[model samples]
Target: MDLTVIWAFIIAFAVFAYVVMDGFDLGIGVLFPTFAVGPERDRAMNSIAPVWDGNETWLVLGGGGLFAAFPLAYAVILPATYPLIIAMLLGLVFRGVAFEYRWRDPGHRRAWDFAFSAGSLVAALAQGMTLGALLQGIRVTGRAYAGSWWDWLTPYTLLVGLGTVAGYALLGAAWLVWKLDGAGQAHARRLARGAALATLALLGLVSLYNVALRPEYAERWLTAPTLWYALPVPVVTALAGLALLRALGRDTHAQPFFLALALFALGMAGIGVTIWPNVVPPSLTIWQAAAPHRSQVFMLVGVALTLPLILAYTAWSYWVFRGKVGGDGYH
Candidate 1:
């Protein structure tokens, strides 16, 4: 068996899970200011309060997996995008503090709310820029990153950052639509409509930019052979976007959120198609970046034993917290 390939998939799954699980809550934080204060904002917070922290578990797994299973990639990628990573970490920390203190200190709730929104927005943008920086390809020499500190601060990266913000806001709006009812749901539906339009527009721009930015990506999508693998992603994504718009317009609750998730899944698939086999991109393949075979096998054993338990408990938590979140709490 190709242990390197297995580890690659494991890390990909971990990152995807982190994005899917944490994206909406971050989106909620991004859209927090738009909601009416008091009950509306409180309900939005209540909806995600139970699962938000749990969602970050996948992030730890993804980062740690990279360090252990693909040390070379970790070593190179970190230096290439250190500023963005630090920004992301700081945003998470501040938002986490704001999340807890808002409840404990009602007198300064407004300030906490601002901190939460700003932190979440910064984190989301930083994460997206980090992705863009990676996709734009890192400068590597020998076994290390040879890029300057500001290599990540390009126009293309900024566009991706904006797109990420729009995408997360859409997810947040869809989530609120799913989890709230009455006036809050109606408001969320309105927000979702705007967010949907913005997200789809940005997704198209980002896709086109991606093609123009890298010949490899363009060849993958426009040429033969790999073209077959690449074609369905955008087509299916468009269909999903249409369905999401339709769901938002109707009386449906859960469908919009799931469709939004479908869009994210398609985005991830597009990324996989773009950068397959290369963990650091441009040059380094998974096999070249991976740790020793014995180490991989050992890590796989631990993951095999622990992953199921994590999945089980995550599923159990969601099940336990199922249904709408109202003014007071879950109903």
Candidate 2:
């Protein structure tokens, strides 16, 4: 198998894992406003406490894979979206600090609560805007970033930022369905319904923007044979979204959360398929962005050995902490 192909997909896997795992914790933070300051909010925090750190672990792997496998692309992507990238990291730092301090002292719990929610909001929006910028296209000229700093700040990307907030909120609310009971569960279901609707609407707008506005994306998607394979991605996303909407009314817990996750996965897959071979938009192919072949060959071994263990450890951690958040949160 081609090492370039292998590494490219490896990077994709890492990114997907990060989004799904961290997405929920981010969602939980986003859902902070929905709950009042009390045991309910405490329960919501505890629901994600055990896994939030673990969820962020994918970031290192994903970014590392990109830097190592496709140095040129990584080089360009960072500089092009530096402000958003810095915002994301800074927001995460604030969120992490709030999580730790919120538990240690109750005197200023409200302050910490604000920090956590604000941090989540900033991080989610920045990350979403980064995604939008990438989808819109990175200005790459012969292995260097050629776009202005403001290039990433477009109306469509900002729209994507808003949509991402709703999407993650959906996941967070669905998680609440799985973990909370009584009023919490009911509130989460309501949030899920609203979030799903927003997501559906944003999905339509994004599709229209990509198809009608971005000619390259439209050309590839409409004209290429790959459309046949890629069509199922959106179909699966729609089915999952619809199923999740339906399941939210039922008594099922994990089903709604799982289906929501499937929706995220399928949407990502659709984007991946649509932009295959191009590491960046406007004709930057993977091979062109790839690092030295020797570097790729050497890293493959480490990836094969390391990735599964990390995934297994993550799985085991989740299994150990499985079930609802009962028993008086945080001692």
Candidate 3:
């Protein structure tokens, strides 16, 4: 494989990691209000506390990789989706602050809880909107963003945002099903089933709408016989959704969580397949947008050294924390 192809796959994998890992944790934050105001919420928080921080490290890797390996994509994509990116950053900051302070200041736990939920909601919504806008294509004028601020505020974008929220909520519920027992698990099962159905419906709707609206995507993923292999992407996503539904009542705990993750992973796989070679669709490609060879070579050395360290600690921490969570965490 070419060097650019290798970096592209690596970057895509990093993006997938962030989406699957931080995706569930963010879902937990979004579902915070579903739990009661006291120990229930705390237990849910404890379920993710051990690994939530590392979950986001993948996002940093993705952004840094893009900036290093494909600076042009980072530049154009960011400018096109300016509002969504800013809002997402703000939401993440707010959520992180609330996560930490909620533990430190008992007096303001309730307020912190509200902040956390709102932040999670906003961030998830923004991410969904960004995906929607990106799929529809960002407006570029002479290699610069020329769209209005509200350009991304389309109905399809809003619908996709809602779908993303539902998907993340399902992931969160699945995690809870694995991490808790008894009452919490029961609550999670209910949430998981509902969110799964909702997500499936939304995913169906988004695909149908996108195929009708974006002819380029339709041509790339459906009309072309060569791309037929990518059909398994959506197929796997649908199967994962069904598996998640079936696993809710099953005795296994990890099955539901992994099944939910499988849905995310399969979907990402499909997207990567559809957009292969193109860092930004209908326009820029990986080779077209890549940084100089010298920069990629230099960055490769750093990524090679640091990426393993990140993965090692991430795996080790999860292994160490394996087992059900009971009672409030950090007590």
Clashing pairs in 1: none
Q: Against the true structure, candidate 2 has what lDDT?
A: 0.87
Best prediction by TM-score: 1
- Residue-level lDDT of model 1, residues 250-307, one tens digit each, is 9999999999989998999999999998998899999999999999999999999999
Ranking by TM-score: 1, 2, 3
The whole-model C-alpha lDDT of candidate 1 against the native structure comes to 0.93
Indicate the residue-level lDDT of 261 in model 1. Answer: 89
All candidates' lDDT scores?
0.93, 0.87, 0.85
Better of 1 and 3 by lDDT: 1
Candidate 2 regions with alpha-carbon error over 4 angstroms:
none
Model 2 TM-score, 2 decimals: 0.97
lDDT string, candidate 2, 1-64, tens digits: 7989989889988998898888888988998977978888999999898889988889999998
| TM-score, cand. 3 vs. native | 0.95
lDDT of 3 by residue, 1-331 (tens): 4778878988988988998889899999999998988888989998888899889999999988988899888888887788999999999999999999998998999999999999999999999999888777777777676677788889999999999999999899989988888898889989998998998899889878877766777776676574578677777787777777788877768898888888877767766665666887767789988888888888888889998999999999989998888774541
Clashes of each: 0, 0, 0
Regions of model 1 farther than 4 Å from truth: none
